[model samples]
Target chain A: MIILEYLTVIFLLIGGFFLLVGSIGLFRLPDFYMRLHAPTKASTLGIGSILVASIIFYSFKGDGVSIKEFLITLFMFLTAPITAHMLSKAALHVRQPPRPDTLNIDQLENIRDRK
Target chain B: MLENTVLAVSAAIGVSLLLNLWRFMKGPHMLDRILALDTMYINAIALIVLLGIYMGSPLYYEGALLIAMLGFVSTSAVCKFILRGDIIE
Candidate 1:
């Protein structure tokens, strides 16, 4: 039981740290394409960690291993990348500006123009 | 001990929420704003789940699920609008 408690605490803290990192990345990143990478990766891991902790905590609470949290985690994992991809595609479609040093600018434009 | 940990985690999520809000408000482009909004809802889900755990209630899970569904749909619709300039066409 003590070990479980320790694990829960560790997971919660790690999850919070990643969530903070993701939000900071969202705020500080310079361009749309660059910014698209952070939350999709970091925040997904963050929330997944927290959900794992929740699952552990509830399972030990005599609730017979609540599966809802697992479902949420799985749902998040599946959807986060899809949303990020769609958002980036929309940004690219509209020619949202990229940072000046970003590579593949002309390549992307060429591809778009050919379509 | 668990309560304190939950509180700290909730506070961290709150800070993230504020940062997301700042980005949403100050975004220089429409896509940036949309991305920020998407991240904000995800942060909100974390907050809601933490709240549910802290409160020891299963009911909040349903609310979190609903938010997750609606948030994704709205984000996709907005992105589609940006891409095609029409959502339903």
Candidate 2:
């Protein structure tokens, strides 16, 4: 029981660290598309870690294992990438500026023009 | 000791939420604001779950679940609106 509590603490701390990193990346990253990548990936994993800790804590407390946290984690994993894709597509449709060194700039511009 | 750990985690998540809010407000582009909003809700969900653990109550889970569902729907709707200039069309 003591070990499980320690593990939960570790997981929660790691999740918090990743959440902070994702937010910092969101604020600091240049270009809309680049910023989109940060929170989508990092925060998803962060939340996943936190949820896992919640599941373990509750189960050990005799809550008979709250599956809702698991469901939320699964839902987040399934939807985060798709959300990022749609957001990027929207950014592209609106011609959100990209960093000058961004690759295939011409291709993206061509796609916009073709639209 | 366990309570202290949860408190520290909550504080970290709160700082993350503040940063996300800064981005949402300072965004020079629509997509940046939208992304910040999306990230904010996810962080909020994390906070709520942590609160649930801290309080030793399962009640907060429902609120977290609702936020998760609503946040995703709103984000997708906003993205669709941006992409097509009409969410329903």
Candidate 3:
């Protein structure tokens, strides 16, 4: 009973913290590829935690287990990486410039040229 | 307890949205703008989910789900278009 409240609060705080970290990382990162690293990892975890909080609250608040949050969680987890991959590939295809001295930039060049 | 936590969390999400918007506006390239837009939609979904929790109803869950699906598809489609001149092979 009381534990559920504690759990929800903890989850909400965790989610909020991660969400802020992700956005701040996105804003502060130096390169487009580096920037891609921020939101996909941090935001997914943030949203996952928040959805977990919602799932826990709703499951106990009602007679049946509210399974909708699971769907969103699963879908987010599955798609975030794919979206990031597509965006990065597109960036590479379009020759979106990266910060000078970016490590292994030649590898990216190889990929771009392979196509 | 949950009520106050929801308030605080929603505030955090709002601040994040503003940051994303700043990135979108000042981005140097189309991909940067797309990235910012991508981050924005995720934050929006989180905001909607937070609202549903605050209201103590799952009424907004459907909207959240739809946004999740649509955001993914739209982002992917845009990426595809930018990758190749045409979306279809």
Candidate 4:
């Protein structure tokens, strides 16, 4: 009904598009590390945008602006990498097979030495 | 207009969830599944926010926040287990 609500809806749709892009990238990307980057970075952005729209809508509706949504977004951004890093470490520790085209940067022996 | 927009956002999010579910089912590895689950959580959060808008209340936002926090903690713990074979250490 209001201009702000319309704009919020448009922004939410754009966020949905980004989410789809992240999913497609997840399936299409060649390898694990590369795939890791796609969902965490892209989809997180997607969700954050939509949440922002919701915040705008709610605030304009005079329900008072909600802070919880923003907090969720902040936590998502913070934890995505930490989770990804742990996964990558596990992948490397287990010597999980890399994709065909992936090049190993360091030897297991060097990894052990560095530890 | 607001109602139509909310419906559209919900539909888009539902479709997104379906795609992520496909990834979860056809995973090549555990990390892939984890990633898919993470994506699902993000979508769910958005869905909840939109639902909150539809209901015109802050209650749904609180639910969304809890889901986000729990999802993050679970994913991180899983990752830790996958890497170190123990959640604590």
Candidate 3: pairs in clash: none
Ranking by lDDT: 3, 2, 1, 4
Off by over 4 Å in 2: A113-115
- The predictions' CA RMSDs to the true structure, in order, are 1.1, 1.2, 1.1, 2.3
Model 3: what is its DockQ?
A: 0.91
For candidate 4, give the lDDT of residue A9: 78
Model 3 TM-score relative to the real fold: 0.96
Candidate 4, lDDT over the whole model: 0.79
In candidate 4 the C-alpha lDDT for residue A8 amounts to: 86
Per-residue lDDT for B22-70 in model 1, tens only? 9889988888888888888888888888888898877788888888888
Tens-place lDDT digits, model 3, residues B5-88: 899999999999999999999988888888889888899889999999898889999998899999999899999999877788
Interface RMSD of each: 0.9, 0.6, 0.6, 1.6
State residue A12's C-alpha deviation in candidate 3, in Å.
0.9
Better of 1 and 2 by DockQ: 2
State which docking tier applies to candidate 2.
high
Residue ranges of candidate 4 with Cα displaced over 4 Å: A103-114
Candidate 3 TM-score on chain B: 0.94
Error of 4 at A115 (Å): 2.9
Candidate 2: count the clashes. Answer: 0
